[model samples]
Target: MHENVRTLLDTLELEKLEENLFRGTSPDNGWQRVFGGQVVAQALVAAQNTVAQDRHVHSLHGYFIRPGDPTIPIVYEVARLRDGGSFTTRVVTGIQHGEAIFTLSASFQRPEKGLEHQATMPKVPGPDDIIGQEELTTRILESAPDAVRHYWMRPRPIEFRPVSFEHYLTGDKLPPAQNVWVRCLSDIGDDPKLNAAVLAYLSDMTLLDTSLFAHGMSIFDRRVQAASLDHAMWFHRPFRVSEWLLYTQDSPSSSGGRGLTRGSLFSADGTLVASVAQEGLIRLRQKSQPDV
Candidate 1:
């Protein structure tokens, strides 16, 4: 297994500190702050630990209250909101420095028959057809800015194969949409809860960047101050993170210093397995005082 993937799995395996409390740490990857997805995944894991094994998470909503300090361990406190006949609800708060940095509300449901319907998966080329991140970096990073180049060169647990590279290459302000193939670098097992946690982690990778597509900008751009404000996900079917999934994303609107983006995850066989939505801060700084 890839070392990065191993690290991610270990990170998600939160240590139990009390009956309804858990602790998790972020990898020392030299980032200024902890990634939002990591907190979301850890919160999910914390919630899952307190729930019945028979139930699986169907939906989760989370808010980013403050930037997480990666240098310290985050303590997750889980609150058992309700345990009903068919549904169980849990609320998790991630604390650091005695303050809440993140909060998540997840609902788990026991398997049962229900109406089946989903939006049609968009027709797109397979993962094998799209160029992987490595090739994209080797081909384009030489002339890219330091920030952009550094971001692409870093090792990650999840791999991305975007269907189109024009935005990154030419900086054309095109449509606010894109399709990228994503998968874990190694097998994360078949446990539904584990897979769901990993899926939640991967969901935050590039969804917010879709909002910048129309402006021919990216979160890596130094002029843009970007951060996820809130995230929500709904799992429609069982999925394995190790397998390839097409992440179709679009930004329906951007205004008032915020952008709203939506995404759908489809299995290799075109099964709609999950959906995600996020709103992020996209404040652009003036060029004169770039450091501010």
Candidate 2:
């Protein structure tokens, strides 16, 4: 595993507290607040620990109530909502400073045969055909805003390669859709819970930004304020984190200072492994600063 991925795995392995409580800490990634995906993934891990071993996470819904303090530990308290023969539900609240900063509800299911069908994967160039970060950075610098360029080029555990790079340049309103290829920097093994947790971690990478594409804006725009409000995901099939997955995303609406975006993850062979939906705070700052 990459050094960062190893760190991430350790971060996910929350410290057990009381029977129903766990504690998690943020990695020193130098961000002001904890990453939304990290909290979501950690909360899911907390929920998974309380669930039966035979059950696998099938869906999760979460809301970001407050910004996380990366400097301190987050306490996750799990509530066993319901446990049935085939499904188990858990509600997790990530607490910091004795207040609720994040909350989630996850459902797990036992293995069972069922009819299945999914939308066909869109036609796009494979990951190998796309220009990755190193090559793209050289080109992005010439046209992208300084802050936007830097944010997009910076190192991250997940490699996010957008098929359409125009949105990061000028604010020429384009379609509210994009396709990106994403995967872990190194293999994190085949543990099912770990695979699901890693997928949850990556799901929050860029959905909200895609919502701003039609308005010629980006989360990096200082004039525009943005934060994820809620996130929802459904795991349709099992998949490995080491392999490339295509994240196809689109924004269906943006109004009342919020933007809604949905994304689908497809394996190399085109099997839709997961679906995600999120809404974010995307209002413009009153006294506009640099939009970079």
Candidate 3:
């Protein structure tokens, strides 16, 4: 495991607090608020703790109610909403400072035969052809703000190879759609549930940026502020995080200071694995360019 990934897992400390409650700690990854993706992943882990190993999480929907303090530990209270012979459902609330910072509803289902079909994966450059996020960050660290260098620009445990990273920043801005491949930095052993949860963690990294692209904005330029308000994910097939998977994202709508983006995940062999949707806050800060 990467040093950072180990630190992150250690910070989470997924321990049982009560019969159905799990306590998750926060790592001060230099963010004032707990990361939305971490909260989602931890909640999924907590939900998994209460279910049988044969069941797999098929879907999860969540809302970020309040900013979670990264200094405090989050108490995840899992509610057994329903349990059937073949399906199990759970609702988990991440609480800090006596308030609900995040809440999630997830459903797990036992494997069963079903009609199967999925969109074919788009042709894109393979992961080996692209540089990892850390390498990219290191090259740009000299120009970044100290805060960004220390936190936002840190090494990403997941590797992402955009279809064309150079085009987004240099060429004519394309449409909101983007295609990229992602995978874990290290082998994540044989736990499908953890792999699914890791997918939940990786899902939120760049989708909201697609909305920014729709307006010809880049977070790198600092012309706007963005934050996720809610996230929803659906697991379509079992897949390993250790291998490369394509993530295709696009934004369809933005209005009243909010933008909605959706993404689909596909295995290298063209099997659709998951779908994700998120609505995030995007506030434009008009920039003053030098007078011509």
Candidate 4:
């Protein structure tokens, strides 16, 4: 397995401190705060450990209460809310420094037959046709901004091939939508719970950036203050994170210093495996005045 992927898996494996409590740590990569996705994934893991193995997570809703301090460990407290014949519910709270930093509620259900329908996947070039992140970074290394360059240069567990690189290159005000092909760098075994957690982690990657498309800005822009306020995901079908999946995203509205974005994750074969919705803080910072 790729070292980064192994690291990611290790990060997701929380230590069972008690029956309903778990502890997780963050990678000491140079980040000011913990990634929101990591907290979400870890919290899900905590909840999953408490539920029966026969049940699989079908949906999760989370809120970011405070910025997490990456230097310390986060303690997750899971509350077993209900355990019906076919469904189970768990609520998890991520705590750090004696305060709550994040909270998530997840629902798990047993497999059962049901009527289902999904929207057709958009027709777009396959992942192989699009430029990979490494090559794209090398192509614009000298010209790209430091933030953008650093982002592409970082070693990530997941890889992405975007449908278009024009927005990142030119910062042109474009439509508030994007499509990116994503997959784990290494094959994570077909564990339903693990795959669901990984999917939740990947869902947060570019959803917020979709909102910035209309403003010709990106989260990397120093003038923009970006943070995920809340995240919600619904697992519609089983999916393997190791395989390429198309992440189609769009921002429907941006107002009151917040932007709402929605996303769908489709397997390479065009199966809609999951849906995600998130609203984030996208306030712009005022430029400083030049010294007199």
Every model's TM-score: 0.96, 0.96, 0.89, 0.96
Candidate 3, 106-166: lDDT as tens digits? 9999999899888777887777777667666766545555644554455667777777654
How well does candidate 2 score on lDDT at residue 156?
A: 71
What does candidate 4's lDDT look like per residue over 1-292, in tens digits? Answer: 9999988999999999999999999998889999999999999999999999999999999999999999999999999999999999999999999999999999999999999899999999999988887678767655888887777778889998889876676678999999999999999989999999888888899889999989999899888888999999999998899999999999999998899999999999999999999999998876763211
TM-score ranking, best first:
4, 2, 1, 3
Each model's number of backbone clashes? 0, 0, 0, 0
Model 2 regions more than 4 Å off:
287-292
For residues 13-66, could you state the per-residue lDDT of candidate 2 as single tens digits?
Answer: 999999989999998878999999999999999999999999999999999999
Candidate 3 global CA lDDT score: 0.81
Taking all chains together, the TM-score of candidate 1 against the true structure is 0.96
Model 1 regions lying over 4 Å from their true place: 286-292
Q: Which is superior by lDDT, 2 or 3?
A: 2
Candidate 3 steric clashes: 0
- Per-residue accuracy of model 1 over 1-292 as CA lDDT, tens digit each: 9999999999998999999999999999999999999999999999999999999999999999999999999999999999999999999999999999999999999999999988988999999986777777778777887876777678989998888866665567889999999999998789999999999999999889989989988887767889999999999998898999999999999998899999999999989999999999988886553321
Report residue 262 deviation for candidate 4 (angstroms).
0.4
